[model samples]
Target chain A: MTERAVCVIGTGLIGGSLMRTAGKAGRTVWGTSDSPDTAEEARADGFDVTTDTDAALRRAAEDDALVVLAVPLPALPGVLRRVDAVAPTCRLTDTVSVKVAVADHVARYAPSARFVGGHPMAGTAESGWAAGQAGLFTGAAWVVAADDGLDLDVWADVAELAWACGARVVPAAADEHDLAVARVSHLPHLLAAVLAAVGAAGEDDLPLALAASSFADGTRVAGTRPELVLAMCEGNRDALLGAVDDALGRLGAMRGALASTGGLAATVNAGYAGRQRWAAARDPEAVRVRRSRLALPALREVGRRGDAVVGWTE
Target chain B: MTERAVCVIGTGLIGGSLMRTAGKAGRTVWGTSDSPDTAEEARADGFDVTTDTDAALRRAAEDDALVVLAVPLPALPGVLRRVDAVAPTCRLTDTVSVKVAVADHVARYAPSARFVGGHPMAGTAESGWAAGQAGLFTGAAWVVAADDGLDLDVWADVAELAWACGARVVPAAADEHDLAVARVSHLPHLLAAVLAAVGAAGEDDLPLALAASSFADGTRVAGTRPELVLAMCEGNRDALLGAVDDALGRLGAMRGALASTGGLAATVNAGYAGRQRWAAARDPEAVRVRRSRLALPALREVGRRGDAVVGWTE
Candidate 1:
């Protein structure tokens, strides 16, 4: 049996890392980059990277390769249009931060493509092909769309690719994935932004001067590039807005409690318990099933139960 | 002249670390712990530790030691009372998280002591003497009181001790220090708690399962002991309330902009700029002065300019 091929479009951190990871797993992986400099650098690093997207899509279609859209949200439509023109029935997925938007773009621009949206929850704040490396996805949760009536074969292909990259496959609906990430990832970014701004507004630089590990940890992601943060927080506007509302409600309650009772035992205790819950679920129980008998709803249920797909026996 | 003797009350993480640090710096240091287990452990670790608070205070007064109160806010009053009874005129300071409250406690209990409030802005989530180590204050900021009419000699003693412990002295008034920490330290704890709670409330454990570095970083401090968090935050109620109001205002604005304009460029950009400012001031310019020539207002102005005291060349 031949290892499935992977065609990645984009050579940023996520895309480039996927390309390296897939190739290292002996998959026939190649990538395309819009930036000539990025393509040259990846090629110089001995990866098959090109500036031509249509040719890559054509080859991917001919070879029945998985076409992973690795571009930012703003670049999605153009790449999807090329996929439509060159490989309308290709096995398609994406590495975008948000999932539902990618699914919508594929429906509009490449409706015939077999799309299984994916997002590998891994990255540093760095960008470009140079920052890409193998094992970037090791131990990370890779979300794959588990919406109803999806192509199980293509979903399997995407999930297997994630597995080969050393990631645990978390089957979730596109909308659910977006909301979950908004709560965990995007909301943290927004909160970090607000905390950093408030801490910086202190008179006499005293706050920053006395800032310790807690302040540093809380604002770590606020140091991420502004454009990238904007793309993430803004791309999932509805979900993030909801998450923000939840956070604001919590903060408002905390403020009220602090102001009225001069105490926040309830908030602090709840947070402590929440943190304990996260710690307890850090290494979730592994769920295994045969790929031949894999049911989408059942797999989604495993994810819902805080279990990760660690194996799919043949 | 020989190094001034040091006496520490409350042998917890901060206190235990100070005992080791001062001993290593060639000062005659001793500490008392209310917890017999903690005192026994510290004594076994080759330091002079006892469970007798009054005896330690009496010796400190006899030896003209700089008495350091390293107790939590709740234990502060009882320890301060001992200082009043046994060493009312001794050189006094503290390592409490909140300065204003400790100052108030000192005024109400041990008013005649030559007191100069101090707080080392360094610690871990772990508590107790077993978690303590030498050099804990290395490269950290140790804030010393610079309120009007402070005993400059005792202030110099506290500042010199911080220097010996490998920390830069940040001269700030008690009220100013409380307000500043309310922004940097206490407020982050609250935000982390709120964030942890919000993230944990996600449906189906999806958010926790998909939590990544950003979520982990933002909620890192939420794992701290709730009692410790409560003490620090509640101890500085007025200042923390003001800080919480500021944060809530920013979060509210972020939610409004994200909901209406579907854009948070302003928030993200401002946060990025704030993070940049923090990075710039990380290794502040060094301010050196002779101990004799150091004026209280001038030293505080140095701190206001984000400069750290690195030397006191005679």
Candidate 2:
């Protein structure tokens, strides 16, 4: 069937990005915001938007539009309940970070809507509609969760939507998605935060001043919005905890081995080899040929001056 | 006193870089190598080079040249003893990551030579003569250690050498420098290693494939030369252990709080704030102006036509 109008219920980063992508794809897009100021901002950005959620959902239902819930976790249930009251017959989807909770809530509150969970693995630490970009999800993995409560045909449509926005569709069970993300995303964020805190909480700012590219890269995620990060940590608490424990056990072993045998070469080598292999596998086309070095002219002129024989400029 | 010709007793990344910088500064530089092949490499790169240690030291002595011990930590003592036997009157310095050991070794093995410990805080995972660059030390902090046995005037000359190479000379006590780098450098390496190992040791490579910029950044140091990284960890063992413990305490508290209180916003916020302050303090001149986003023109025209509702050529 031809694509129908998409009602984006929240126009923050993810939703705004979806609307922008959909607009670029020549689809009719309607958006709503949590506040009048945001609604005004979205409208100013050329979106057909409003602060009236019930009216928007009812209009979406009347038009047989696809409704996308793209609000924060704490706000999802109320939105679902509102959707059930006004737009139950319309097919629905969501862009939430954690899937298991979203699946459960969708089942209980909007059972009449055929729903699948989506999580486009894109975006920066910055949020809000202001942070949105038309190409936000391009080249990213947009997870189309196959939650048992979700419908197969609807998921195909959801996957198609993801593809339309230039994302690779990754099908996964809700719990599996949550577990994978907790390990890949949440655990790293927590560790980075701790690392940054360690840098700041030191005897002084020496560590911070001495923090080069490596330290900055290692802790970049720690500088993200705390509220959003805390939400992910809370939502995937168990899996994140497991990942933390696993990493800590290995690191503690590395420290002990360093103290004793003067060897952690095995671990370091493994990591180096793994990253090389992973990079090769992920982008086979980008592998570079071996590079050559050194071919210059020779020179030597010797002289002596003082006890400090090497030249000093200042 | 006029600066004299210098002999560099290794031709790896750091040594080659120093030779290149000194060459650019119009000093006659002679470089030694572990083997003939490396000496050839240096010669091809336009360096006055030698493979014979005694021959190199004697040449340095005859010219009243300064000597830079640019070998690995394990190789330093032997080179220092060789300097004592052949060029004892020539003042000396070294480019080793750790400092206290270098200070002690200099005191014991090269008593007649004025010695100062140095560490140019620059470089990448790539090493050897092939990785050398003329401006490697530019904009970097080149630590000049104030070991009790080290001559103050020799250090001033050494600091001037660093300055002439376009570096900012940071004067510090040997132990203090060791402790600071332990907290900043070694600890980050350990964490990145463990983090990369965690990514590799997962159930599959999905985590690796999905590893984004954050994971890549956080684990970058893990991809550096395993042998060199191993040396840093082992050389700075005591200070590294202290940093590890301190970071673990904070991280464990974060994990525990995440598991129990359903509230870690405070800790996350603290870390976020810390990174911002650290970054601002680290590069105050580079602070960016705030940017605004989005005010696109509105448009919406929705309809459906089969799978073609969204145009797809694939």
Could you estimate the TM-score for every candidate?
0.98, 0.85
Q: Which residue pairs overlap in candidate 2's backbone?
A: A1-B306, A2-B304, A2-B305, A2-B306, A3-B309, A297-B46, A311-B3
Minimal lDDT window, size 10, model 2 chain A = A298-307
Full-model lDDT for every candidate: 0.90, 0.72
Q: Which candidate is the best by lDDT?
A: 1
lDDT tens digits, residue span A1-314, model 1: 33789999998999999999999898999989988998898888999999999999999999999999988898889998899999999999998889888888889999999999999999987887888899899999999889997898898899889999999999898898999999999999988988899889966788899999999999999999898888877899998888899888988888888888898999999999999999988988888778778798888888887788987775
lDDT of 1 by residue, B248-310 (tens): 899888888887888899999988888888888898788888877768898788778777887
DockQ score of each predicted structure, in the order shown? 0.88, 0.21
What lDDT score goes with residue A161 in model 2?
78
Task: Flag regions of model 2 displaced more than 4 Å.
Answer: A284-314, B1-4, B284-314
* Per-residue lDDT over A170-258 for candidate 2, one digit per residue giving the tens place of the 0 to 100 score: 55667766766776677778778777777677554545655666677778898888878877678777777788888878867776777
